[model samples]
Structures are given as structure tokens and as C-alpha cells.
Target: MIKCNNVQEQAQDLCGEIFERWRELLQSGEFILGDQVLAFESWMSDRCGGAHAVALNSGTDALFLALRALDIGPGDEVITCANTFVATVGAIVAVGARPILADVGDDELLSVETIAPLVTDRTKAVIPVYLRGRPLDIDPIIDLCRSRGVAVIEDCAQAIGTMIDGRQVGTRADASAFSMHPLKTLGGLGDGGMLVTRDPGIAEYARIARNHGLENRNESIRFGINSRLDSLQAAALNIKAQYLDQWLKRRVEIAAFYDDVLSTTRTGTDLGRGKPGNAYYHYVVQSTHRDELQAYLAENDVQAAIHYPVPIHWQKAWLSSQPRIALPTTERLSRQMITLPCHHHLSDGDVEKVVTLIKQFERAVRW
Candidate 1:
């Protein structure tokens, strides 16, 4: 059976370099905020077009730190898509802020139009997630936020290398958080994340905050959390970073084939949001019979999944805390979308098989 990603095979291809770096990292004994982490951060910041990059233990912490840097707490309101991963909403709650939902469009992107009404005087930041690796056409959103003096902290957990208008997406926002949770386009061997910002002050604050507010070896500048990114994982990422572009290219190729075959149906873009640079984190399609289609794929030995089966607004966790938020688009899209395995490890023939299975399921449903 063709797996979603043959991670072991992909890693084995680079184990020689990773183990060599590992041996060096062990010798240095600067495990925490050491040379490996600094090297990865330097290379990463350059790639992200950020003035600084703050590496952390997880993407959840990255978002939380970004929020903390902006001083979003207590009654401050944060606007984000209702269809995004729970981490996006959880981060706001983690920082003691309220998470307001914005509906998404057919593109699975939350736009300025959808978010405009939700903004208010208490709006501290808007975390527009680049869902499914396609960066939102966020110029309008940024312009609106800037007019009101609201911060735009883009949730770029999915789109590390995505570009819009010849520049990287992370560079477009005041700050953006990226995940390397072994599943992202630039995945690490384990959980890892980074926060990038153009502002030196925010960068400095986040950097210090990630290390328990340490000003010096033993001095505490403020109350902070321990969320530093591991050097070992950084070493692994350094090895994998070399092949990110190559792997992304393969993912794009697979996405193109899926797009052509699934075009007649309700499918998300393979290349993503009218750009060749999206990370293609997930190749998703909208199927009214989503549950049936998923089961069919399973029977056929194809592992299809869902980005989210339910919108965050409707989740028991959110609805219980807050009143029902009206988000028809988010709710509908959640039920309709089905994620197919389009990882770099799959061959062209594997992709063809996935498409064929879905087409067969659709035909069976029609009959």
C-alpha cells in the first residue's frame, strides 16, 4: 500500500548528514540554545524574510508567544478563521483573549470581506491562517487592520515558503508563526516551531520569553514559559531543510495531477490560491458524501482524512465557553472537505490510484 508519506524512507536518504551533525551537537553540549539552533534560526529567518526568528518547542507556543509579545490578554479579542486547526483558537485562549470566528470562502480562505464585520475596538490582533498551505490574499486584510491600527499576526503554520506578489507570506505580516511538527512542509523530526517578525522589539520580547524570561544566565526579566526549540531537532531540520524545495516541488507535481483529475468536482486548488509556491500541506476536496468517500478510500487501502471534521465554533469545547457563533460557510466546508494523501513519498502511479478510487466512489454514488 502507498502510505501518505514514507517518512522513514525520506529520512534515511539524509541520515548520514543528520547523524554526523548529531555527533557534533553531542560534542558541543550546548544542547538548549546552542549552535545548532542558532544556525537553523539564521537560515530560517533568511528564508522567511524576517528581521528575527524565535524558535520554540511547538507551533502552539509560537502563536502564544506572538500573542504575548503583542500584550493580548484578558478582554482583548483576536479574530481568526473558524475552520482552522484548534491551535489557532487555543493560542488566543491560552493568552487569555477571546477568539472570534470569521467565515471562509470557497477557496477555504478567510478574507477581509468575511472578517471586516467582526473587527471591533477591542480587536488586538487578527490571526489569518494560511489554511492548506495557500496564503490568503491578505493585502486587503492587512490594509484594513492597519487603518484601525490592529496587528496582523499571520498563522503561517502551513505555508512556510508560500509567496504572494513575489514575496514570502511570513514577510507580509507583522509577525507569523510556523510549525515543524513532523507533518509540515519543512517538518522536523519532532515537534518544533518558529515565530518571525519584522519588528525588533517584538522579536526581542519573544526571544527572551521563550527562555523563561532570562536576561542573563540566571536573571529573570519577567515571568515567562520554557518553550525553547531543541537543538537535536534543529540539527534534523538543518539536514531536511536542504531538501525542502525539492520535496515541495514533488508535492506540487502530485497536486497538479490531482487538480487536473479532480477539477470537475468540488476540490481545493492543488497548486494553491493561484500560486506555484504554496507548500501543499494537504490536498483536499469537497465531497457531499465525505464519510462514504473516506470509507471507500480506506477499503481500497488509500488513507484519506479530514483537515477538520467540525468547525471550531461548533466544537463542544468552544460552544460551551461562548455563545453560538454564526458561521455557515465554515460549518458547511468542514463537512464537505476530504484530505487525500499527496505527500512527497508517493509515486505518480500512487496518485493515479487515489484519483481513480475517488472517481469510482463518485460514480457509485451517482448510480
Candidate 2:
């Protein structure tokens, strides 16, 4: 069976190094905000073009902290894509701000064109999510936000190590949030996240806020949440970080194969192929027969999935709170896109099988 990702195999491969680090942490007794976490943060900073990286418990918290550090709260409005993971919009709500959903381009990512019309006097920040690890040409978005005095907090949960013009995506924003959930490109053993920024003030505020606003053991400067990254997970992440580029390269290779073959199909079409620096977090294709194709893959022991079956604006949880808006591209893409397994673990034969099965399904549906 060709699965989305062979996480266990990757974990097992790194167990020896992870266990060694775990044993060291166990003996040292310095758990929270310890050496392991610092080491990982240092690596992240260097990789993300010298940004100050603040390690946190989760990516959602990373976004929330970025908003908090920027003093974006009640009465402020945050603009983000409607097609992104719920975390992107949820972070705005978590910080007591109103989330404004923006439509996406053909690349399934937010652009200045889609977002410019929605900006208003209350706009506090713009979180352009690098969905599916496809890096946005963010300079224009940054320019747009900068001219209006709005902050750019990139939602980089899926796009770690993705570069644009030889620089990483996270470095260009006011602050960027990255997730290390087990499924992410730079995933650790468990949940972990990082906030990257060039601003020392934002970094300092996040560092202070993440530890319950602790200036010291007995001092509390302000009310804050406990969002510290675990030392054990950081230790595991430090080990996994070494192989991230290798894994990403493999994923790109797989994506290229899928793009080459899937482009000719009458029933399915690949999106966002020509974009450079795409990390290919999910190899997505749009097909009118999405449900049928997914079932066919499952029957053949080839696992396929949906990145998102529903857009955020349509989600029942936010229906009443969210303004009724039309996101034509987002709504249509959600129903048509199917995510195929595009991971480092898949062999050449596994990829070929997936493509073959999809083509077979395409042929069968022609009638």
C-alpha cells in the first residue's frame, strides 16, 4: 500500500539519535526552555535568513503570539486566505480580532491583488499562508501592507525552508509562524512551532509571553499563556532538521513526476506547477471526479486524501461570526482538489503506481 507518508519508518530511522538525546535530557533535568530548545531555535534562525526564531508549543500559538507582540487585539482586523488551514484564521480569533477571509490566486495562495481590496483602516496584519509549501512572491504583499502600516505575519506552517529569490519565505515578513506537527515538512516527533522575525522587540516579547509572562521565577510582567516548546520534542526536531532538505528534495522529485504525467489528463489537472521554490507539502490536483478518483485509489491500496473539503467561510463554527462573502476560486478548488501522497518515503515504483492508478481512473470515468 502506498500511504501518504511513512512516518513510522522515518521515526524509526532516527530513533537511535533521538533516544541518545532523550537520555541526555533525562539526566540533565533541564526540561523547559532548555539547551535543546535553544539549539533548535538557533538552527531555525540561520535557516530562515538570520531571523530571530522563538520556539513555541504549536504553530497556532506562534501566530497568536505574533499578533499579541504586535499589539493586535480587539477591534483589529486580520486578513488571510479562506482556503488555508483553520489555524490561520483561528489564531486571529484567539487574539480577540476579527478575521477577514481573502480569496486566492490560481496558485491556491493569497496575493496582493486578491487582498488589496479588502484592506481597511482597521487592518492590523496580513497573514499570507504559503499553502502546500508553494512560496508566494511576497514582496508585493509586503509592499502593500507596509504602505498601509499593516503588519505581515506569514503563516508558514507548511513552508519551512521554501525560498524565494535565494531567501527563505519566513525572513521577508514582519513575523512568520511555522509548525512542526508530525505531518509538516520539518516535523518533529510531536507538536512544536517557531515564530521567526527580524525584529528583536517582537522576539523579546514572544520569549517573555511564552513563559507565562515570567521576567523571572517570581515575577509576572503581564498576563500570558504557557506556550513553551518541550525540550524532548526540540531534541527530536534538532535531529530531524538535518534531513529536512533531503526530504524536501525527494518530495519535489515526486511532485515533478506527478506534474509531468497528470498534466495531460482530461479528467484531472495539476495546479501550481511552474512556481519555483515550492516545497510540495501536498501534491494536489483538481478533478471534477474527485470523489470517484479517491475511491479508486483507495481500492487499489493507494491512499489519496483531500487537503480541505470545506472552505473556512462555509465552516459551521464560523458561519454566524463570519461575514457572508463569495470566494469563487476557494470554494470551487476545495471541492475539486484531491491530495495525493507526495512524501520522501515513497519509492519510484510507489509514485508510478499512484500515477498509473489515477490515469486508470481517468480512463474509466471517460464513459
lDDT against the true structure, per candidate, is: 0.84, 0.89
lDDT of 2: 0.89
Candidate 1 lowest-lDDT run of ten:
265-274
TM-scores of the candidates are 0.95, 0.97
Residues 25-128, model 2: lDDT tens digits = 99999898889999999999999878899999999999999999999999999999889888999999998999999889777889899999999999999999
Q: Candidate 1: lDDT over CA atoms?
A: 0.84
Error of model 2, residue 343, in angstroms: 0.8
Badly placed stretches (over 4 Å) of model 2 are: 267-269
